[model samples]
Target chain A: AQSVAQPEDQVNVAEGNPLTVKCTYSVSGNPYLFWYVQYPNRGLQFLLKYITGDNLVKGSYGFEAEFNKSQTSFHLKKPSALVSDSALYFCAVRDRYYGNNRLAFGKGNQVVVIP
Target chain B: DAGITQSPRYKITETGRQVTLMCHQTWSHSYMFWYRQDLGHGLRLIYYSAAADITDKGEVPDGYVVSRSKTENFPLTLESATRSQTSVYFCASSESSVETQYFGPGTRLLVL
Candidate 1:
C-alpha cells in the first residue's frame, strides 16, 4: 500500500520569508507525487507534481517542490511567502508500479503566512 | 461555467436518510473521482469512474455508492446517511488516469 505523511500540523511563516512544508512517502515501487492547496470553502487546486524527471519541480503561484529520492521526501517550498498564501496544503502519492492509479493523501498542513 | 461543478453546495440531513450528490464536468474527462475531506484526514477517495459505466471502489467505499451513466456526470449516493459520513465532498475529473485532476467547488454535507 502507498501512503504519505505530512509531519507538521501547521507551518507559520512571516511575509516575504521563505516557507517550506515537509512531506514523506512510503510506496512499493517508485512514486508519483503531487501538491495541492485549498482555500476556505474551496476545492483543492493542483500546485505541482513530480513524475520522473528533475528533482526540483516548479508549480503554480510561485511554488516549488524538491523530490529527494534518497530520503523519500518531497517538500514544498516558496522563495517568498505572501499573506494571501495562507491556506491548507496537501501532499499525495501514488505508486508507479500499481496500475489502479489510486492516490493516498496525507493529513494536510495548514499554512499561516503572517504579515 | 467551463469547469467541473457539484450540485447542492451545502446540505443537512438526518440519520437513515438517503442523500445523493451530483457532479458534472464540462471538460468531458474520462476519469472522475469522489473524495471526502475531514479535519484530520485530508481527503479520502470514496469511489472513481474510468469511463461511462465503468466505476470502482477506492480507499474508503464502505458506505458510498457511485455511478457514471455519461462521460460528464458522476454522482455519489449515500444509501443511509450516518453522522460519521458528514464531511466536505469534492468531485474531480482528469483527462486520463495519469493527467492532472481538476476539482469542483465541493459539497458540504451535515448528517445529524
Candidate 2:
C-alpha cells in the first residue's frame, strides 16, 4: 500500500503571499512525486519533482509543483512567499508495487512564512 | 559538495544496547538510503542500496542492519536496541533510482 498524504498540520503564509502545501497520493503504478524541505535541524532540502512530464514542475528555492492526475494530487506551490520560506514540508512518493526505489513519506507540513 | 554525513550527531543508548549508525557520502551516489524520523511519522524507509554488494528492505525493516561494502559507506546496525528504536536517523543519497534525494545531518537516537 503505497501512500503519501500531508493533510496539513500547519500552514500560514504572509511574506509575499501565495503558497500552498498539500499533497495526496496512493500508488500502485505511475507515481513519482516529491517535494521536500526541512530546516529546524537540517537535512532534507530538495524541493520539487513529478516525474513523467509537466503538469507544472519546477524546483529548488522558488519551488513549484502541481501534478494532479485527476485528484490523486501533488501540490506544493509558491508564487512568492519567503521568510526563508518557513520550514518543514514533505510529500514524497515512489512506488510501482515497490520494487525498492523506496520512498513514501508525508505526514509533515508546517510552513509559517509570517512577516 | 561534501554532501551526506551522519555519525554520532547525537546518541544515548541503553535498552539492550548494540548500535552503530554511520553513513558517509561524497557523491559516489549509486543510491543509498536509510531513514527513520519520528515526530509525526514521516520519512520512514529503513534500508536501501544499489551498489557494492546491493541491499534492500524498506518501509521499516525491523531491528535494522545494513551494509554496502563500499560506495561511500552505508552503515546501520541495531541488532538489539529498542525503545521503539528512538529515532531521527537519516542518511540519503541518489544518482539514480528516482533521482534527487540527498540528506544527512541526522542521527539522534536515544533509547533508555
Candidate 3:
C-alpha cells in the first residue's frame, strides 16, 4: 500500500519570506508525487508534480517542489510568499510501478501567509 | 464552460434519500474519478472509470455507485444517504492513468 504523511497541521509564514511544506511517503516502488492547492469553497488546483527527471520541479503560481529519493520526501517550496498564497495544500502519491492508479493523499496543511 | 463541471454545486437532503451527483468534462479524457473530501481526510476516492462502461472501486466505495454511459459524463449515486455521507464531492478526469488529473468545482452535500 502507498501512503503520504504531512506532519504539520498548519504552516505560518510572513509575506516575502521563503515557505516550505513537508511531505514524506511510503510506497512499494518509485512514486509519482503531486501538490495541489485549494481556496475557500473551491476545488483543488494542481500545483506541481514529480515524476522521473530532475529532483527540483517547478509548477504553477511560482511554486516548486524538491523530490529527495534518499529522504523519501517531496516538499513544496516557494522562494517568496504572498498573503494571497494562504490556502490549504495537499500532497498526494501514487506508486509508479503499480498499475492500480490509486493515489494516497495526506491530511493536508493549512498555509497562512501573514502580511 | 470548457472545463470539468459538477452539479448541483450545493445540495441538502435528508437521511434515506437517494441522490445523484453529476459530472461532465469536455476534455475527452479517458479516466474519471469521484472523491469525497472531509475535515481531516484530504480526499478519498470513491470510484474511478478507465473509460465508458469500465469502472472500479477505490479507497471508499461502499456507499456510492458510479456509472459512465458516455465519454463526457460520469455520475455518482448514493443509494441511501446517511449523515456520515455528507461531504464535498469532487469529480476529476485525466487523459490516462498516469496523466495529471483536473478537478471540478465540487458539490457540497448535507444530509440531515
Candidate 4:
C-alpha cells in the first residue's frame, strides 16, 4: 500500500526564518508526491509535486520540495517564512497498487509563522 | 467561480436525512474525486471516477454513494446522513490519472 506520513502536528517558526515541514512516503514503485496548502474556509491549493527528474522541485509562492528516494522522504521547504504562509499543509502520494492514481494523504501539519 | 464551484458552501442537516453535495468542474478533466476532511484525518477519498459512468470506491467508501453520468458534474450523496459524516467535503478534478488535481472551494456539511 502506498502511504504518506507527516510526523509534526504543528510547526511554529518566526517570520523571515527558513521553514521546513517534514514528510515521508511509502510506495512500491516511483511515487508521485504532491504538497498542498489550505487556508481557513478554503479548498486545498496545489503547491508543488515530485513526479520524476530533479530532486528539488519548485512550486507556487516561493515554495519547494526535495525528493530523497533513499530516505523515502519529500520534505517541503521555504528559505524565508511569512505570516501569510501560515496554514495547514498536507502531503499526498499516489497509490501504486493496480496503477491507481488515487492519492493517500497524511494527517497534515499545521504551520504557524509568527510575525 | 469559473474554475470549479460547489453549491451551498455551508449546509446543515439532521441525521437519517439524505444530503447531496454538488461539485462542478470546468476543465472537463477525465478524473474526478470526492473526499471528506476531518480534524485528524486530513482528507480521505470517498469516491472517484475515471470518466463518465466509470465510478469506483476509494479508501473510505462505505456509507456513501456517487454517480458520474456527466463529465462535468460529480455529486456525492450521503444515503443517511450521520453525525459522524459531519465534515468538510472537497471536490477535485484532473486532466488525467497522472495530472495534478485542481480543487473546488469545498462544501462544509454539518449533520445534527
Question: Which stretches of model 4 miss by more than 4 angstroms?
Answer: A96-99
* Candidate 1, DockQ score (0 to 1): 0.86
Best by lDDT: 3
**Model 1 compared with the native: what TM-score?**
0.98
Clashes of each: 0, 0, 0, 0
Every model's TM-score = 0.98, 0.33, 0.98, 0.97
In order, what DockQ does each candidate have? Answer: 0.86, 0.32, 0.81, 0.88
Which residue pairs clash in candidate 4? none
Model 3 earns a TM-score of 0.98
Model 1 C-alpha lDDT per residue in residues B9-48, reported as the tens digit of each score: 9999999999999999999899999999999888999999
Interface RMSD of each: 0.8, 8.6, 0.7, 0.7
For this target, which candidate reaches the highest DockQ against the unseen true structure?
4
| CAPRI verdict (incorrect, acceptable, medium, high) for model 4 | high
Better of 1 and 2 by TM-score: 1
The lDDT of model 2 is 0.88
Residues B1-112, model 3: lDDT tens digits: 3499999999999999999999999999999999999999889999999999999999999989999999999999999999999999999999988888889999999999
**Angstrom error at residue A29, model 1:** 1.0
With a 3 Å backbone cut-off (N, CA, C), the pairs that clash in candidate 1 are none
Candidate 1: regions farther than 4 A off: none
